[model samples]
Target chain A: MQVTLMQGILIGIFAIIAGIDFWWEGFYIFRPMIVCTITGLILGNLTLGIVAAGLTELAFAGLTPVGGTQPPNPIMAGIMTVVLAYTTGKSPATAIGLALPFSILMQYIILFYYSAFSVLTKKLDTYAAKGETKKFTQLALLPTWIVGLSYGIIAFLCVYGAQAPMKDLVNSMPVWLSHGFEIAGSILPAVGFGLLLKSMLKAKYVPYLLIGFTAACFIKFGNLMPVAIIGVALALIEYNRSKKDVENEKKMKAVMENVNNDGDDEDGI
Target chain B: MESKNTETTPKRGKLTKHDVKMLGVRSLFNQSAMNYERMQADGWTLAMMPALKKIYKNDEKGLADSLKANLQFINTNNYTAPLLMGLEASLEENGEKRSTIDGLRIALFGPLAGIGDAITWFTILPIVAGITASFAKQGSVLGPLIFFLVYVAMFFARIPIAQLGYTTGTKAISKIRENSAIVSHAASVLGCTVIGGLIATYVQITVKTKIPVSAGHTIALQTQFFDRIFPNILPLGYTFLLYWLLKKKNVSPVILILATFIFAILFSWLGVL
Candidate 1:
């Protein structure tokens, strides 16, 4: 069954709520797994939602935002992919298609929140001036819960309601066009892979990657054997070859021993 | 109970460019730990301390200064919400309504958390982890060994960023801007690879068939295809094609999805996934 647009909106709402509820933990709360799980519950296929969530999770498992650099939105992708997959039978890749825009929209929301929070500091400052230390902490708690709860509920409803209508709409489309959606699904995951590969393929390490892949493909060995054996052998060889100042160490040791004997001889005489 | 030293010692002697570079990592790490929103309200105040010393040293402001920033190099704070909450609660205690502050914060937290998590844990870690882990997962008993090597490199690499964040935040933006471009490019390269790897790992498919030999026996896929060349390379190729089209063509993922469904239907009708 295709998801009715109303259901699509519901799933979105559900995602928003669960997404920001981690206020105590602050803005680090929005995770793909959280949104995906909510999506699963909304779509009434908790298991598939989990699987989708896990795949998305592992795919972006190493996201590390350093400073202000941008990172691709995994939670948005996770939610949409689940919605699409459960409602339309598209694979994980197809679901990723709908998630990107939501992720982008969420980004600006963060910018606003970050800047707006500064005002709270001013209020706290005012309290601090009045010699009311306890009041400063109190002023901070209200905003945290309000925002956290709002995001949680909004996501819950958006995802929950969107589930049915989106499925219906997608399914009701011409059968041929439906086929087209499936085709799109197959090709989309590659984008995720490509994004990953752009970092993996470095100029120096290309040989290691190729060799590892080749050994996996060719060698009739047990799991994880060929690569490990070769890697260890190469590492040992490199360590041995890179031994620095070997001759200098020997000369330094000889000089130290000579000095000790000379000192003893002088003392005895 | 013991105030052995009234002031902390600063590093003596002229600092080199190398030292400056290393501080960025340290500064970043410290910035990452800037939770407790009220404390973090200065927005990189911890970083600007060296410069802050010049401005506020021995000033009449009686607040003691002890600051550290930590987020493991993904420089976003988790304390802001609580910080706001604390501030609001304090105001409430003083007999003022906090509804407006609540609305303002409600509107703020969701979007920031969404992007922050995505960038920190999603893009940077995976790309770095995937490549770093790939070395080990491919290694067997030595795999764990390889993982440690990568981990050490990443761990040590972060120290300077943390320090730099603290030092740079203290002064002007001139020094920070100079290095941002190179760092961004490096980050992008890493991020791009993750984009690729995430796709590669997404959809897993298996095709099974048995071929009969002359002696009245069938061969396993392992025995038959294992002897052939580039056995799983086809999947890699497929991912590349998808990535290129998406990036170059600007085609919507939805359209591509429709195409995939069509393809799957045709393949299924012809019996292929």
Candidate 2:
């Protein structure tokens, strides 16, 4: 489990990416597939990665970023869950079950940093006003990248530092407690999925949702096939609806023009 | 907002638009950037209103006033400070009236959300955590570095995006009257493609479950079809139940925590993986 130079660099890069997402977009960038794939690629455990990612994804599928509100920090959860799974050689489900509480803790840090960064915004704005592109870029990119990279580096150090002790502590967790986590993990994602599904509700979109649900419950196309299908359906529906509306408008405009001509004839008479 | 004794009917306890923008200054010291993180719509307006008014209406102060009107937008209101500013400069360059700010915001929101989701969520966040996770998986000692990387990225990246948004918003609006189709289409394509890629690459889940069949009873009872095929009757049922609870409840999501913990305990005790 010794951190290699290459591995360390990779971790730093991912950390930066995560930080950038928070700074720029403001949503949970982590996902189960992503966590699994990265962990798998890094640890030479593709199956483990997929499993871990799947577990994490399911456990937290419903989490979404709304306006000013924060959900649990999925990036933290997904990353940590994968790492825990890989290091411990535990199943994805088990890893996810164990990681939820830990992940929840990181959300506060994210909130704190976001609130704290207002100070930096004013400084950057003043710099930008003076046409200091270099300073502006420096201000904009450096802090976030630092945040992202530092998270990875620090986590790496801590994990490296605590490996043996944590392993013993986890191994010693009671059977019932461990099993409880598994069950809780299993049920958690439903809430997330529920939230997502609830948020996307609209009359026109309901048909696609039903289709997705049916496919999920019965057909089994796998992964997000149902969701993708919904996306496509919505797109098509919007397109078709707009197209028809345009055609109808043209017809109405022609009718209006005819009526206007009749009025001109009456005025001339 | 201060209360009144019917001299103003207390004015619904709402602050005037000026109060909102002034509050933005307080929020500046108190908070930064629009909080688009809630998956809500407030951030877009908050982050862009001030800048948008300046760009389209030739009124920088007006932009500030508009924001005060829309202060309820929370996290998004702060970032609008930068966006509207850049947009004002961009519009002034084109010699256009600044009245078109509202159109610009409506125009930009969808494309921004689409692009924003991918740019922030897909590309940047993953890159950071991917690096960190790689090490964490191997029991590397740099787990905390991964966390810090995210913090850094969050802090640094906002300025330019907000700035760029302003510049683009003002410019993009004018295009609506001149080759609007091409502009919106391009934005749509970029937005959709990024979203598609992210959803495909992320969101990983695998499911296995079965229905129970009622065939036989006590002595030499035989279980038929569903149970014979698989033994996951409970997991699927539990998933559905959880979904049901979520759909039915108006209760605070905190209740979900209680339910999750309770189920986890129950399942663990019952030996349900």
Candidate 3:
């Protein structure tokens, strides 16, 4: 189960790519679903990679970067989830719980980068003023390189350098504590859903939420497709109704304008 | 004086299709140098650089001034930033008043961010991720493939959207605002429903505690009591509690995550989970 040095290096390089994509929001391969699967591929455990992808993806679902504030680093969470599970021979669910500290650590590092990158703004301004387009472009890309390199180093160290200690630490944990991580893993998705609902939930949408929840919990489907279809239907209906409402409002405004014009004409007469 | 020059100059520099396309490509790095002081200001300038250079090829002072104006604390969704870039390119090409261009940029970025966040981040990505994660849970490679393809599609969509913004000029603003309101609303409805199903399917909590019902038999707490009342009441109730704490108490997500770990471990040790 030990990760080979070559595999570790490959993962580090992948982390670099994912890290830049995460910061750039370019390809979005930084998402857990993609990150974990690729990590799993390199580690020769594709099944575990896909399974962990599902767990880690849901666990980090609602943790999006809004404005300047970020949630815990998804790239780290995704990488470490597979790494811990692969190295320690634990369930991916248990590995998710164990990966929390690494995710949070990366989050702080990113926050620091946000502040540290401010120093470059003055130089950027200078370049822009002088119309040094080439220099300006190079300077603008500097932060992304730093971000990618840091991810490469950290992933290499964590996956390759710390494998033995990580395995020993997991082996030494008491039965209950290890079991606790499994339970915690199962429960952690709630925080992600809660964070999502905080932003997206409204009183009007409660009924739909309840419907979806009840359907999933009660009706044993092979998959979630039925619930997704229902959601799509509901969204379509909502879209049509809102379109009509917009049309009606426009009509009402037109009538009001006509009424005002009539009154002005009568006053003129 | 500037207005007089612009009115008299009928042969102002124009943007080519190639230039517009490049702007869209550059927008992928719109947050590359994101910093605390000016946020995406530097990236914004970078994305618009080629277009600005072309538009002000004959005037060095005008190019310098435009670059300075563009680098003034801009932050918006990366996908939709192309629209703004195109719009600014058109304005600069027409030699629109600097004040007019600045005012429009400031006015639109906030609303664009709102619409972009609602559609891309909250609605589309979450719904797709939810469905794909379900497939992925069963070890299906289709899950990651689908999600990645959808994201790439969105990325490429920036090109046509930018072109639309450029051709439509200022006329598209009100229409975009109107359509986004409806689109975001519908998307939210879909997003909420998907999230609800996700909560039930993803969040797992089962009561392991049991009570003695007879000398030789014991009633299972989870299957007999909790499941009888509601199949997933614990997960749903726990999700609600976390939501209340998050929305009402305004606790940080990091704190909430840590608290969940503590509660899970402590409760497991006590044999209650």
| Number of the top TM-score candidate | 3
TM-score of each: 0.47, 0.58, 0.96
- What local lDDT does model 3 show for residue B248? 95
Q: How far out, in Å, is residue B217 in model 2? A: 2.2
How far does residue A41 in candidate 2 sit from its true spot (Å)? Answer: 3.8
Model 1: DockQ score: 0.07
List runs of model 2 lying over 4 Å from the truth: A1-17, A25-32, A44-46, A66-68, A124-134, A220-238, A249-269, B1-92, B97-258, B270-273
DockQ of 2: 0.11
lDDT of 2 by residue, B211-259 (tens): 3356553321123433454333333344445546666656445467657
In terms of docking quality, how is candidate 1 classified? incorrect
Tens-digit lDDT track of model 1 for A85-186? 776786654455445555555545554555566556655445544434345445545455455554555444435555676667766767544543444444
lDDT for A120 (candidate 3) = 97
Per-prediction backbone clash count: 160, 90, 0
Each candidate: what lDDT? 0.44, 0.47, 0.89
The deviation in Å at residue A88 for candidate 3 is 1.0
Q: What TM-score between 0 and 1 does chain B of candidate 3 receive?
A: 0.94
Clashing pairs in 3: none
Better of 1 and 2 by TM-score: 2
